[model samples]
Target: MRFDIPLPDDTARLEALAHLDGLVKPVGSLGRVEELAAWLAAAHGSMPPRPLDDVRVVVFAGDHGVSDPAGPHGAVSAYPREVTASMVRVFLAGTSGVTVLARQVGARVRVLDIAVDGELADVPAEVTAHKIRRGSGSIDVTDALAPGEAERALAAGMAVADAEIDAGADLLIPGDMGIGNSTVAATLVAAVLGLPAEDVVGTGTGVNEAGRARKVAAVRAALARTADRASDPLSTFTALGSACAAATAGFVLRAAERRTPVLLDGVFSCAAALVCAELAPEAPRWWLAGHRSTEPSQAFALKALGLTPLLDLGLRLGEGSGAVQAVPLLRSAQAVISEMGLLADLA
Candidate 1:
């Protein structure tokens, strides 16, 4: 689908900045929150950007077939593809951390079964199923997805974003739900940032010390497997990423095209942002780094994106729960920009 939203007007943004400077508080005292409002206005081509009343979170779940190897981490044999659907079921049941946090922030949560292999019979009505393939091909031996499949996954995500926008969703938070996703995330980060696997690999889902070592080794193997392939961003994604990664990248691009703000979660989300930046550089301006995850690779990805997260609660959850926690702060920033009294008015 083609999205053709116009860029924000420069003159209108300048005027909004001036008005912000004249607010009651000290200039720039509101920090990133004030900047966020100004950014919204700039994105909308208005003096004061309007708060998005319809906030929806899309959590794309997939399965990675590359977690079968037994290495220094003693082989994550229990991390099966079925775990992807199991956790997604938990998310749909509103029992996962992401569901709880989203509810607290007044944001609707929607789970997408992008490429899970098993049947999700008990999935809630709100959860969407867009299974592109049973599961991604094993990156340890070959590419994770076919080139055409990667593009289809991306388009699927864009279609979801379009539908959400059509339904009046002003803000979009595209998240991920998959076991062994960190391996893909690390590879994507390493590929896009031109870094080695060791630099971007980290233990995910509470892996022990040995498990962390094995995860890093798996990333190296995947990188080596795809070494002869082109270093193009899409190529890297199709080689090492899951459907969740491609979908998230598409969601980010669509959000930028519509001038909507996107709150990024942890490493998985950041990996998607890296792909989005490679595809559409301007999209990062529309993103807000919600928080820094406990994962080391998340920090590397955030730094690569030049985004300082609003919170540093040492969160490592991937269900977009970390991002949801920052909604209150964003709301407070909007309040400061639009509701705070002027000095003259107080006098």
Candidate 2:
């Protein structure tokens, strides 16, 4: 439960900045790209960090009962809750947005079903080995998880990170797949940041105006329910966060613990990261905002985390697409820092 992880090496970052400045280019022509390289160097504690040869994307999939059309809250998503399971099949078939992008960058993709509502046929057992329940409870009226489920989901995420790192993943991207997840994520953000529902709720999954209003109302109710637990991270998560999001929080914490650079996708990732940062204040140093998601909560969460996004493409998709889109740019930054000739060498 206690992260207490070390921050990246500042000495290595300073040295990398010096090396970038000494490169055959203007003092700050590369802009944030230069900063990105320095960050990787610091994360690795080396002047020239290792190549991002093995990038891995882990998508945590689940269902939110609040999204159930039959539920009293009604569906706040454009898609039905059944789509969560269908999307998992698409991910397993390697045809999802995250999978396609990861393939383009030669990165591996693994979709874990942390709390999908129903059974998934033809899926590898490893994907569901950490399944905590059928689905998380509706946060608007009930706790997202029963007691002790949050801890199990967190441990599942940590184990997944360890396995990926042990398998030679140099870079990691945590994605999300679930209908109405944005509602769940926005609720978590509002609770942890003391923000009102209007500030955190958005048009998640292409919801209409009425749907957005419902979302805001739902978040407001959840906030009131968990207002007292906001100071305690675990209690807050248990009350307002989905199982997949709790797992995502654990994944972020463990990646920082291992000093592996992480590219955060969108609202889901950032909201979970907010909880992780509360758990370990130093964890955000090892993370980079992959892009500026259109999700209002994402922007607020990134601002809270003090991260600058590499791209601002108005992305609202949550399946790590934004992070994957920024991979080439990160690699270019890595190349400039690790391969560009020093000005003195040119002389």
Candidate 3:
């Protein structure tokens, strides 16, 4: 299915190149800033790429079936599944890293309760509820989600993108928060790349050696169930992606369709981006990787997408913190390309 994602506008992008070349820097001295400026110009489809006037961070919250501490992988979580619900409250209270960085950047924070395993009592009126299922089925035993549930999550994500655009958001960042999420991400990556889980899986949420071993085992067993379907992105997602990742994939595609630029976050974000790329080949054109995470699977995903991140501070924190931290650099790049004095004029 060819999704409706728009191709980057080459004409405007060429114009942006000319505009950046006209700046006082000795042609590309600004490095990735120039690269980002060109991409913004294409994505915005306008000259000067307009300052990043408004940015929106959407945190997709869910819980993993592997997170049942009483369940088989329960031995794998640094925290319980209930923490997913509690963290939603923390995000709502604006005390998390994403909230603080977004507030500093003058951006808005919107949390979506797509499939949290527990209740978020008295959630703010704005929190979008697009829960496709209470929690995913265990991929090691069965498909994480039914195909119909995956489709519903995708449509809900598209709707969220439309709502943000209507509300005047020019830049969108999708974040993921879920317990035992790394297992899901690792499963998707391993299956898609036909890689052994040991190469792709890592210590998530600060798991110990034994926990990492359990995660690897779970991912390997899941891929055995995934066998043929593993190579197809959407099928892999249906087979093992967390609800949050699947929704983020849809949101990424929809944002690209709207021509909004996105700075993608770490491992889980890259996993979603892989699905986005698979669903629509042109989707990655409208986004940039904000950082390369410590997770080996994230690197594998980034390699597949052909995106190079702007920073590498050894960051592994999710919730869009790494992506948001790169926003100022985006602003600086825009300013340098749009406001710096021309070299000819200086001469």
Sliding window of 10 residues with minimal summed lDDT for model 1:
69-78
**99 in model 3: Cα distance from truth in Å?**
0.6
TM-score quality measure for candidate 3: 0.96
- lDDT for each residue of candidate 3 in 1-347, tens digit (9 for 90 to 100): 67777788899889988888888778888878898888788877777778998999999988878666666554566777888888889999999889998899888888889888788658965564677778887777787887678778888888998999889998899888888877888878776667898999888888899988888878888887767653566676778887777899889888888888888998988888887787888889888998878889999998899988888998877899889888998998787767887767884
Write candidate 1's Cα lDDT for 9-120 as tens digits: 6776687677778888889887777777776677767766677677899999887777655433345333666778788878867899889988887899988888786787
Model 3 — which ten-residue stretch has the worst lDDT?
67-76
In model 2, what is the error at residue 220, expressed in angstroms? 1.0
TM-score of each: 0.92, 0.98, 0.96
Q: Which ten residues in a row have the lowest lDDT in candidate 2?
A: 226-235
What stretches of model 3 exceed 4 Å from their correct place? 228-231
Clashing pairs in 2: none
lDDT tens digits, residue span 1-347, model 2: 67768879999999999999999988989998999889889999988977899999999999998887777667789998888999999999999988988889998999999999967967899889889988899888899999988888888898999999999999999999999899988987887788899988899888898999888888888788766653677777788998899899999889999989999999999999998888889899989999998889988899999998999998898899999989998899889998898889884
Candidate 2's error at 115, in angstroms?
0.4
The residue ranges of model 1 lying beyond 4 angstroms of the native Cα positions read 1-6, 69-80, 122-128
Model 2 C-alpha lDDT versus the unseen true structure: 0.89
In candidate 2, how many Å is residue 104 off? 1.0
